[model samples]
Target: MTDLPHYTEYDTRLAAYAVIRDDDGRVLLALWNEGDQPRWTLPGGGVELAETVEEGAVREVLEETGYDVRLDGLLGVDSFVFSPAQRSNGSERPLKAVRVVFAATVTGGELTPEVGGTTDEARWFPLDEVRGLPRVSLVDVALGYLAAG
Candidate 1:
């Protein structure tokens, strides 16, 4: 028998996010505090194994921002691959992030910061001011989708 080369195994993370805008042209955002430099991002997170993407989006938003949201429509999908060196956890294998974005509207609940979670605070920012704030690339991606429509 011939010998074969070994291949590294990688992990893929599937997450869901929402782009929520009010009538006042303000967008809802959450502060992702898991890294050394916290940055603003859409209010959502990883999809649980047992839940659908839509259900996960709603659950994450409620958990992070204390808001009940109704997904209006599908925005788009964003995918990125992180090399081992770029991963925060320093895993040997590359990681593929598949994010599902959706257009959402607030149904109820008040703005509240997430407790003991990856996100620390949630707030609304005027669309014009959002460009000046520190934020993750996903924020820009989601905004681009909104602008396209």
Candidate 2:
């Protein structure tokens, strides 16, 4: 019998995000500072084990943007796979990211940047200007949902 290499187990990450837009034709975004270069993204992140997806989305939005949001409805889900070499965490196994996206409305709270967190800044960008901003792929996915809805 010939010896064979063992297969490595891949990891799956479940996250929640919100697409919040104001009546003034501006969309909320947070600067993701954990990567090589900071880029704008939706205000949300990994879902905690103890919370539901909806709860996670709300919590993440609050944490990143300092905005109290009420989720109106689920917009869509985005799935992407990162090869081991492409992962920022330096893991040897591939990672599958499953992101749950929701449409949300700001009920309260003011626009404030996150402190001591993965995101350093939060701001509202005019819809037309969003296309020129440096952002992650998730932003495009969320915007696609907005266009379709």
Name the lDDT value of residue 66 in candidate 2.
Answer: 87
Model 1 accuracy (lDDT, Cα) = 0.94
| Residue-by-residue lDDT tens digits, candidate 1, 21-58 | 99998999999997669999999999999999999999
Which residue pairs in candidate 2 have backbone atoms (N, alpha carbon, C) closer than 3 angstroms, thus clashing?
none
Cα error, candidate 2, residue 88 (Å): 1.4
lDDT of 2 by residue, 42-90 (tens): 9999999999999999999999988999999999999988888989889
The C-alpha stretches of model 1 lying farther than 4 A from their native spots are 1-8
C-alpha root-mean-square deviation, candidate 2: 3.7
Task: List the global CA lDDT of all models.
Answer: 0.94, 0.93
Candidate 2 has an lDDT of 0.93
Clashing pairs in 1: none
Model 2 residue 23 CA deviation (Å) reads 1.0
